[model samples]
Target: MPILSRAALVEHLVRTRIAGDVATPRDNNLSHYRKLANGDRHYWLGLELGDRWTDEQDVLAVMAERCGVIDDPAHRTGQDTIDPELTVDGLERMAARLRKAAAGQERVLFATGHPGALIDVHSRVAAALRAQGCDIVRIPGGLVADEGYVVQFADVAVFERGASLWHTHSPEPMNAILDGLGEDGRPDLVIADHGWAGVLAQPVQDRVHGLRGVG
Candidate 1:
C-alpha cells in the first residue's frame, strides 16, 4: 500500500508540523542565504557552490524554486510557507528510489543528521532494505569527525559527540565514511537527510526549506 494517499499524506504533514507550522524564522533563512551567497562552505552542506552566487536574492531564487517557498525579497520578517504538494512529491520520490534499490539489491548507506526526529525512520527503512537483500553498508565505528566520532547504530550512521548522537548540520561525518569506503568498495546508493544527504546523495537538490511565520 502507499505510505499514505496523497491527500492523507498532506494532512499528516500539516498535522505533524512537517510542512505547515514549520519552525524556521525568516531572519534565520535570509541570514543563511546571505552567508551561503557570501561563500560560506558550511551552509553549502558539501555542495561546491563556488562563487556562482554572489547575491543573496539570487540564492533565495534557487532555494525558492527548489523548496516551494514564496520568492519575494520584499517580504522580510515573517514565516514563509512550504508547499505541501511539493513535500508530498519529495517523499514519494524517495519511496520510488527505495523501491529501485531493493529491486537491484543495491549497496546503500544510510545516515541522518537529525537523530532525535528521524533516527527511527532511517533505521526502519534500513531494516526493510536489508530484508530485501540489499547491502546496508556499515561505517567503521568511532571514525574522527567534527571534533567528535562517526558512529553507527541500527544500521544508520550518525555524528557522535560527547558519547551521544548529536544534532548536526555538518557533512564531515558522511565525508569520513566515503573516505573510508575508498573507490573500490563504495556504496551503490546513499540514503541520508540534512547536510550529510546534501553532500553525498543524488536527491539532495530536491530537499525543501521553509520559514516559520513569514507568509
Candidate 2:
C-alpha cells in the first residue's frame, strides 16, 4: 500500500473514527474523567497525579485541552470529539520520538491496551525500528492474575508485524514486563497507550511515551 499524503491521512483518520468525533461515547469519556478526578487508581492506571487534580472541573479542562473533548460539564451525552488537529499534532510528536530512537538505535518496547484498534500501527513502527537496528525487547511469560482472570504476557507482545493481544485495560501486564526487565536490561524507550502506557509513564516518566486512543 502506498503511504498517504498528509491530507489523505487526516481524512482517513476522520473517516475511520480515529480522529474528529471519536467512537468513544461522550458518557464513557465523562465517566472516565470523573474517575480520574476522583483519583481512582484503576482509572489512573498507575499515574501519580498531583493534588491539583482533585477538582473534576480541572480534570475536564485538562482533557478538553489535551484530548479535544467537550469542556462543558453540562454536556454529558453524545459522541465525544477528538480534534483532528490534536491527532495530527500527536502523530508528529510520535514521529519525532521514533526518529530520535532510530537515530540512537534505542532499545524499545511497544504495547497497547486497545490492541484491536492499534496493533497494526504499533507493529509497523516496531518493524521499522527493527529495520533501523533498534532492539525490540520481548519478555515472555509475565502473567497477571486478577479476580480469577489471568492475562498472559504473550498476549501483549509487540512483534515485528502483528500483536496477539486484544482488549486489555489492566496495568498488570506492564508491571510484569517492567519487573521482568531486572538484570537483562531496561528498554530505553517504551511506546504504549492506555493502561499499559499510563503505568509505564509512572516509573520511567522520561523514557516512556503514551499515545491516546491506542490504549
Candidate 3:
C-alpha cells in the first residue's frame, strides 16, 4: 500500500475516527490529566514527568500542543478533538525513527499493553522491520513479572498469567524481559504503549535504548 501524504492522512484519520473527534470521552481525558497532575504514576505512562506537569491546566496546554486535545480549562467535559496535524506529526516522527532503525538493522522489541487493540499494529511493524534486516528480538521464556510469565504472540511481547495471556500496563513484564536479556543483548528500540510505558521512568541501569510509546 502506498503511504498517504500528510493531507491525505489527516483526512483519513478523521474519516476512520483515528483522530479529529475520537471516541474517548472528554471526561476520561480530563480525569487522566488530573491524575497526572496529582503525581499519579499510573497516569504518567512510565514517564518521569517530575515537577513539570503538576498543574492540570499546564498538562492540558501541553496536550493541546502535542495531542490536539482541547486546551481550554473551562471546556471541562464535552467533545474533544485530537488534532490531525499533531497526530500526523507523531506518525512522521515514528516513521523517521523506524527508517533509521531499518537502515541500521537495529534490534527492535515490540510490545503492547493494549493487546486486543494494538497487537496487529505491533506485529506488522515488527514484520516490516524484520524484512528490512532488523533483528526482531525474542523475549526470553520462563521469566515471570506482574504475577505473570512474559510471553510473545504475533511477534509482539505480552504477559501470560493464570494459564492465559492477558493485557497489562505494568512495566514488570518488560523489566523481566530486560533482566532476562542479561549480558546477551538488548534491543535498540522498544515500541510499547500503556502501562508498559512506565518502565521508562525507572532508569535502564545505563543501558541506552529508545522507548517509543505512541498514545
Candidate 4:
C-alpha cells in the first residue's frame, strides 16, 4: 500500500476520533508532525520466530516505515545502546535504506560493522535494492563500531556496523559525507533499523512517523 494513502487513513482516523470528522489535510503529504500529534500508528514490538532470512531487518524496516512507526526502540531519541554485532538481518536493513535513498535518487550513505560478516547479506541486499533503482556505495569501514554514535553525527548514515569503530570513526567523516552531498534529496526520508540512542534524538523522532515489522 502507498504511504500517502496509509497516512491519509491515519489522519482521517485521528480527526474522526477527536472531531467526528476527517481533517484530510490539503497538502496530502503526511508527515511526522501529523503522526506524532495524532499518536503513533506504526510501531510494534516483537522479534520474529527466529533469524530465518538474510534481509529480515530490511523487510521489517520497510514494513515499519510504511506503517508509520520507527522500529525496535519505540522512542525517537534513539536506542539506549546498540548491539556489538551486526547480524545478517541488520545488514539487510541498511541495504534497504540504501535502496530507498537510491530510488529517490538520494545519495546513499552506508556504514556497518563486521564487514566480512555483512558483505554477503549487504551484497545481496544492495544488488536487489540497486535493481529497484538505488545507487549503492560502501563506506570504507567494513565492520564499524560505535555505529549508533557515528550515525547520530552523520547527515544520513546507515547503521549496520557494530560498536568497535565508534570512537575511531569521528563524527567529522559523517559530517563530511553530508556536506559533500551539497544538497538534500527531494522528499527526504531517513529510515533506521538499529541505533537506540541515535534514533531517539529529538529531530529524528520528530521526522519519523512510524515503525512496522515485517516477516
How many clashes in each candidate?
A: 6, 0, 3, 32
TM-scores of the models, in the given order? 0.86, 0.80, 0.88, 0.29
Ranking by TM-score: 3, 1, 2, 4
- lDDT tens readout by residue for model 2, 64-165: 999788888899899789887788888889889889989999888777777667767777888899999998877655344232222323323532212334
After superposition on all CA atoms, what RMSD does each candidate show versus the true structure? Answer: 6.9, 5.4, 3.1, 17.6
Residue 68, model 4: lDDT of 33
Q: How close is candidate 3 to the true structure, as a TM-score?
A: 0.88
Residue range 128-191, candidate 4, lDDT tens digits: 5556666554333332333343332232343433443322213233333333433432123333
Q: Would you list the C-alpha lDDT of every candidate in the order shown?
A: 0.79, 0.70, 0.81, 0.36
Q: How close is candidate 2 to the true structure, as a TM-score?
A: 0.80
Pick out the ten consecutive residues of candidate 3 with the lowest summed lDDT.
206-215
Q: Which stretches of candidate 4 lie over 4 Å from their true place?
A: 1-107, 113-116, 137-170, 184-215
Off by over 4 Å in 3: 201-215
Candidate 1 residues 14-52, lDDT tens each?
888788656787778899999989888778876666688
Which of the two candidates, 1 or 2, achieves a greater lDDT against the reference? 1
Instruction: Give the distance in Å from residue 166's predicted Cα in candidate 4 to where it truly belongs.
Output: 8.0
